[model samples]
Target: MDLVGKVAYITGGSKGIGYGVAKKLLQAGMKVAISGRTLETVQQAAEKLGKTDKVLAIASDVSKHGDEKKAVAQILAKWGTLDVVLANAGVGHFAPIDEMSDAQWHAMINTNLNGVFHTLKASVEALKKSKGYYISLASLAGTNFFANGAGYNATKFGVVGFTQAAMLDLRQYDIKVSTIMPGSVATHFNDHEPSPEDAWKIQPEDIGDLVLNLLHMNPRTLPSKIEVRPTRPDKK
Candidate 1:
């Protein structure tokens, strides 16, 4: 698809993978809107990305269907069409099933699982009109079960499953759907600070490039699921 002049909406785009994708899309000449839970953070990120008419920052919570509806409405009001929707908003709360609190499990499900549904539901109509793409940022945890990761695992697993089925269902309308499952990315996820020492981890911009590639792929092909990881582990 021609990326120039396309319209895209990215959830939780204030930072991390969402922001990375947003930056790349902007560079490709797309009008992009990024949303975060807080208006301040979203605006700050927009400013950092260089405030311009091509970019929009909105405060939205994907966990709430209403918020996503409003966000998509705002994007359409501004651009008149939506060509891409990236459901990248997520939160992680890891704990053993036996020890996990209700809050932790619910938070994971609400943000990482239900959030994707809300975002997709809100944007599906616009996407149907444009026959656009819908991509979700899942994780390797979706397929790999680990100790002390029950909550996080369940949500990601659901995301992967949901996206795969959505892909099949949406194909009839020519709306491309895919899930990107990245491992060990250097981002502020799970309260980890990224540092130079974390060079072995996959960088956010790497995912950005991957998203761009996906966008430019042949219209006849759909790479519905992708798993990416760092090439090497950190040496002790």
Candidate 2:
């Protein structure tokens, strides 16, 4: 697809993978809208991205349907049409099931799972109009469970299932859907700070490259589920 002028929306785009992907899409000549829970942060990112006509910043909480609906409406108002949606907003609260607080579990479910559904619901009609693409940022934990990760695991697993099922349901409309599961990405997720010592982990731009590849893939081919990992996890 020719990316010039094509408009894309990314949730949780203030930093990390979402921000990284926004940079890549803009570089490829696409107009990009990035949203976060805070307006100041998203605006700062948009300013850093430059191309004032091509970058839009929105304040949205993806877990809320109304917020996501308002966000999509703003995107349509600015760009006239939406060509892509990236459900990248997520949170992690790791603890043994017996010890995990109700707040932590619900936070994961509400943001990681319900957030994706809300984002897609708000954007699906616009996608049908453009026959566009929907991509979610899941994690390897979706498939591989580990101790103290039950809540996080359940939400990501739901995301993978949700995206795959949505792909089947949307294909007839020419709307493409896919989920990307990445391992050990270097980002400020769950309050972990990134530094030079984290070079061995997958960088956010690596995931951006994958998104670009998927966007440029043959229209007839649908890579609905992708599992990506660092080439050498043992290096560190």
Candidate 3:
């Protein structure tokens, strides 16, 4: 797809992988509307990017239906059309099932799974018109189980299935859908600060580049599911 002049709506675009993808899209000449739960952070990030005219920042909690509608309405008001939707807003809660609190499990399911649904539902009409793309940020945990990661794994696994099924459902309308599952990205996910030890992990920009590549791929060929990981994991 031609990125120039395209308009994209990215959720959780204030920091981490979403911010990196927004920066890449902006550099590619796409107008983007970035949504986050915090208006201050979203605005600050937009300003830092130095393309305010081409970027719209809106505070939105993807877990809520009303928030998703408001964000989409704002984007349409600004750009008149939406070409891409990246459902990257997610939260993580790591704990054994027996030890996990109700709040922890709910938070993960709401943000990581239901949030994607709201985002896609809010953007579907515009995307159908533009024959656009929908990308979801899953995780390697979606396919691999680990101790104390039950909440996160369940959401990601659901995401992978949701994205793949959505791809099949939307393809007839000429809209593409894909999911990216990456391992150990250098980001502040789950409140973990990135450190030098993260050098072996994938960078946010690498995922950004991957999104670009997926967009540029021929329409005849859709790489529906992507799993990316560090070339060299740290040895204990």
Question: Which is the winner by lDDT between candidate 1 and candidate 2?
Answer: 2
Tens digits of per-residue lDDT, candidate 2, 1-236, equal 77899999999998999999999999999999999999999999999989989999999999899999999999999889999999999999998999999999999999999999999999999999999999999999999999999999999999999999999999999999999999999999999899987898899998889999999999999999999998887452
**Cα lDDT tens digits for candidate 3, 31-135:** 989989999999999998788899999999999988999998898898888999999999998878999999999998999999999999988998998999999
lDDT against the true structure, each candidate: 0.93, 0.96, 0.93
Q: In model 3, how large is the Cα lDDT of residue 166?
A: 94
Write down the lDDT that model 2 would get. 0.96
Least accurate 10 contiguous residues by lDDT in model 3? 44-53
Cα deviation of 127 in candidate 2 (Å)?
A: 0.1
Q: Candidate 2: minimum summed lDDT over ten consecutive residues — where? A: 227-236
Best by lDDT: 2
Clashes of 1: 0
Better of 2 and 3 by lDDT: 2
Considering only N, C-alpha and C atoms within 3 Å, which residue pairs clash in candidate 2? Answer: none
Model 1's TM-score against the true structure: 0.98
TM-score for each model: 0.98, 0.98, 0.98
